[model samples]
Target: MISSTQVVTLARRPRGPLRAGDLAITDQALPPLRPGDVLVRNTWLSVDPSIRIRLAETTPDGYLPPFALGEPLAGLALGVVVDSRSPEFAVGQHVSHLCGFREHAVVRADGATLGGYGGLSVVDTLDHPPQWFLGPLGSSGLTAYAGVHAVLDVKHTDTVWVSAAAGAVGGLVAQLSRLRGATVVGSAGSPAKVEYLRERLGLDAAFDHRRSPLTDRLAETVPAGITAYFDSVGGDHLEAALDAMNPGGRVAVCGAIAAYDAETPPPGPRNLFQLVSKSITVQGYRAGSYNDLLPAMQREIGEHLAQGRMHYEETVFDGLESAPAALAAMLEGLTTGKTLVRLDENRS
Candidate 1:
């Protein structure tokens, strides 16, 4: 068993964009285990856009509290129990929890509250890599599943548009929508990502959002107006979606990466009246609110994986020290699929 571990903590609240000095890595001794405690050796950590909100000095009301300066930052992680003092968890068992940005974690056998996903649960990766729990088979997958299946209710005849189509959640949204028989259109930042959406994910059409005006590009691809829109990038993308939405269209607002680290509030869609004119329905949700759907989503995604109908990509950083860069890359749109920090390099 390890006697000490390294963890990443916020050195200071970021101003505007995050900087290297804003995060610090330090080592400390493990606390002595209590009667109900379990010690875990973390193997994988997830880097997500939501963490950017925590780096601020204060978050909006009803949002998660900002990360305290000089304390360890947290997110989703997969680990193995190395030592246990409780009967609920045993050594060698694999589990998923919210103790990431660290090499080791000590938590109670009853599990800990992690934002909205509920208590930690034993995760059996089966024959797949344990890191899969941090990406396509994990929270990211669940988020996309909820957006496509529950929020939008995409149908075979519907035409769907997804912004940030190459991203972890948005990529799955595109694929799942296509699987449901919808005509899917997507937008990404670059040519490579555009190709990935078209050739790899099999979207009906995709274009580089940077190559032309988003409205023009979306209009070109979806001339008939979209029946369902899965939005990951807000600002102009949302505005464009509003302009191209069919009457009675449904939109699932997933994330707004464009405003995540902006110093000033981004302007809201200029065509706000479109919602009134078209009777559009727009709903925003967090992945945590749909925990009840995980089992069904898991079974469906697993079948897609087995049949080669679904594919996922991940940009992995080597160690805990690389986590800050990984987060920055994800926020800057430099990553594809899921961005992950792999702590246990020897495992795969």
Candidate 2:
């Protein structure tokens, strides 16, 4: 059994974009397991935008509390139980936990819930690659599923637009919308990502948001107006989506990555009045709040994967030491698909 583990901690609150000293890697001795605890060797760590919200000292209402300085940062992870004192979990069992950004974790069996956002549960790697649990079959996939199906109510006849469509959740959202028979348009930061959405993911149309004004590009791509909007990048994208939304349209506000690290708050959608003019329904949600949909999401997404009807991409950063860099790259929109840190490359 391992006696020590390396962990990444929040050295300090980031002011804008994360800096070199913001995150620190430290070695710590593992604590003795309690009666209900299981020791896990973490293999994969998911790098997500939500972690940035938790890094701030004070967050807006409804946001999770900040990560304590000098304490290990938490996210999602896939691990194998190395030792266990709990009957519910046994040694060699694979599990998911919110103890990522670390090489090992001591998790309480009772405290862990199965297969949803922020919940811990035993996972079966036979169905898919273990890392898939961190992306497609995990929180990102669940968020896309719930946002599109439950929140937005996308229909076969609907026309959909997704911002950050090349990203983890947004990518899944775009594909799922298409599977639902919606005509999907997507926006990405680069030409390559736009091409990825168009050629690889088979989005109906995609544009590079950096090349032109979003409103103009959206107008050209979705001239008839969109029936549903899955928003990840806010600010200009939100304003553009609002401008191009059809009457009675629905919007799932998933993330505001554009303003996540901004020192000053970005302006709200300038077309706020359009919400009333067009009678649009805009709702913001966190994936964790919709854990009730996990079972259905798992069944559907799993089937899609098994049938080769769906595809996902990942940008991997090897080792726990690369986690902060991977996170920074994700926030900068430098990564495509799901960004992850692999602690044990030998596994998968």
TM-score of each: 0.95, 0.94
lDDT tens readout by residue for model 2, 62-162: 66677899989888899998899998888888899888889989877777442335655898766688898889888999899999889998899999999
Local distance difference test values of all predictions, in order: 0.86, 0.87
Q: List the residue pairs that clash in candidate 2.
A: none
Tell me, by TM-score, which candidate is best. 1
Candidate 1 lDDT: 0.86
Task: Please give the lDDT score at residue 214 for candidate 2.
Answer: 83
Clashes of each: 0, 0
TM-score of 2: 0.94
- Model 1: CA > 4 A from native: 345-348
lDDT string for model 1 (238-291, tens) is 898999999999999877777877776589899989999999999998888888
Q: What is the lDDT of residue 259 in candidate 2?
A: 80
